[model samples]
Target: MRKRPAEPPVRREPEAPEGCLTVAIRIPVRIVVLVLVVPVRMLWDALVVAGRFLNDALLRPLGRALLWLGRAVFVWPFVALWRWVVVPVGKALGWLGHVLVVVPLVWLYRYVLTPVGHAIAWVARGAGAALGWIAGGVGAALGWVYAALLTPVGYAVMWVLKGLGAVLAALGIGVWTALAWLVKYLVVVPAVWLYTWVLAPVGRAIGWCAKGLVWLVSMAVTGIGTALYWIARILLVLPALAVWRWILTPVGRVLAVIGRELWDALGHAWRVAGHISLAVGRFLGTLFRWIFVEPVRWVYRSVLTPVGHVVRDAVWRPAAEAARSVGRATRQALAAARESVRQARADFRRMLFGEPRRPQPVDRREPSGRETRTLGSSTTALTKD
Candidate 1:
């Protein structure tokens, strides 16, 4: 019976769905990873290789070419200019400056200025020496004249003054003595005699009367003074005292308090006004700087400076050159005139003196007798004249 039950397992077939078929595919993990990641990695590697190629093939050569071009166009030319043109030009300019300006300045200072200064100094020294000689001669003449005339005159005048003073002193003493005697006799003696004789009794009576009158006047004056004092006390002093005590003191105190308060208020107002004024002033300063000062400065810098440069170059430089030329011409004319004058002076001297004498060195020896006689005669003639 078990063998009959163990009949062949029924071969049951799965039923097919009616709509869509769903298929399941089995893939290896390595294949999935390779399918997802390999293409991205390969693309990244390709990009990197392409970039390296571009850098090596294009960028390196381009950078090198640009460097060489910059050197050829800019750096090399600049170096060459600095070495050949600029350096040589600078050296030549320096030499020209030394030759034209510095050398000329040194030459003028040494040859012209120094010689002119020495000539001026020598002329000054000669003039000074002449002046000194003339001054010495004049001083000697004045001394001789003073010794001959003024000394005796001064002594005589002094003696006359002394004699006159003595005589005046004697006269004054005698006059004073006479006046004193007259006063004693006429005034003092008469006064004494009159007092002793008739004037004594009369004077006594007058003095008594005068004393009585003085007493009466004094009593009247005392009464008047007392009345005036009392009147003043009642009319003026007491009223003034009362007014001061009652009205002026209280009014003054009230006024003082009011004035104090007013002064405090004024002080506060003044302080506030000062603060406002300072703020206003600051604001005005800033506004003025921006509006006036900055614009003026901008105009000066942008317009006036360039205009000044133009004026200097166009007008002043040419004017200065013309002035220098005129000055040079004038100097040449003056030098020629001076030379002509010198020649004329020499000719005149030669004509007058029958040929100008050669200059001789000064001798410091004592003059001979003949020379002394001639000098004295000339000095005498000059003094007389």
Candidate 2:
């Protein structure tokens, strides 16, 4: 590339006056501030004024009205209720509860519960004492029983056991000595002599004789047993089999046939009797229905029920009403009499015990208006009842 021509010397512009530049910058800033901040401040002021106006004109009055309404409708009424009704009722209830429940409970605990607890404790102590005494007596009785009976029995038993032990020991020693002597003298010597001299020959002869005799006897017995077996088989077994097969079998079959016939006859008779009984029962049921049930139903429908309705509607109802009226009148009269008696009694009591005071003229005028009104109302209530 060709060497770039030397760049022209850059010409810098002369700097503006600092005051003018500052003034120009401040003018724009002030214009921008005036454009933005002035309107914003005015809007803020207007909003504050509007807010104040709304607070004063709308919100304040609304709040005051709502507060007044709340006070009037809810708060004042609630306060009044709490002060006038709730407090007094609460106090009255508290007093009544104290009188009815707390006082009674305290009295019960003091007079009844405490005394009952003490009595129970005393009874428990008595029972414990009695049980202890019983235990002591039982122990004493056991000790006495042991001393009176068991100790002597134990000693006697011990002595008897000792005597028995001594006797048994003596018997054991005698038996041992006798056994030793007998073994030495009788058993060994006899066994040796018999083996040497007598046993061999005698055993041979006895064996030979016994063998012959056993053979003869076996032969004889075998013949006798075989003969007797055949005889018994022929005489008893064959006859028994024949009798069972022919005579007893026929007889049993005849008896079975007769029994079956008798059973069938009895069953037939039973079935006939059952049928007859069912027929008789049906006849009786029909007769009862005709005689008793129909007549009773007819009577009840035609006579008894109508009569009962008449009595209930005409006689009983009127009687009951009359009786009620009479009872009410009687009750009212009795109440009036009781009131008069009470009044008289009160008057007498007053005369007898009332405080000494200046005598006042008795107005003999017919009862006062209030008294007449009360009497009239009472009489009206009683008459309505």
lDDT of each: 0.82, 0.82
In the range 97-177, model 1's lDDT, one tens digit per residue, is: 999999999999999999999999999999999999999999999999999999999999999999999999999999999
Residue 330 of candidate 2: its Cα lDDT? 100
lDDT digits (tens) for residues 116-225 of candidate 2: 99999999999999999999999999999999999999999999999999999999999999999989897898899889897799889999999999999999999999
Best by TM-score: 2
Model 1: how far residue 126 lies from native, Å? 80
TM-score, candidate 2, is 0.39
Query: In lDDT terms, how accurate is model 1?
Result: 0.82
Candidate 2 residue pairs in backbone clash: none
After superposition, the stretches of candidate 2 with alpha carbons farther than 4 Å from their true spots are 1-202, 260-272, 355-385
Off by over 4 Å in 1: 1-265, 344-354, 357-385
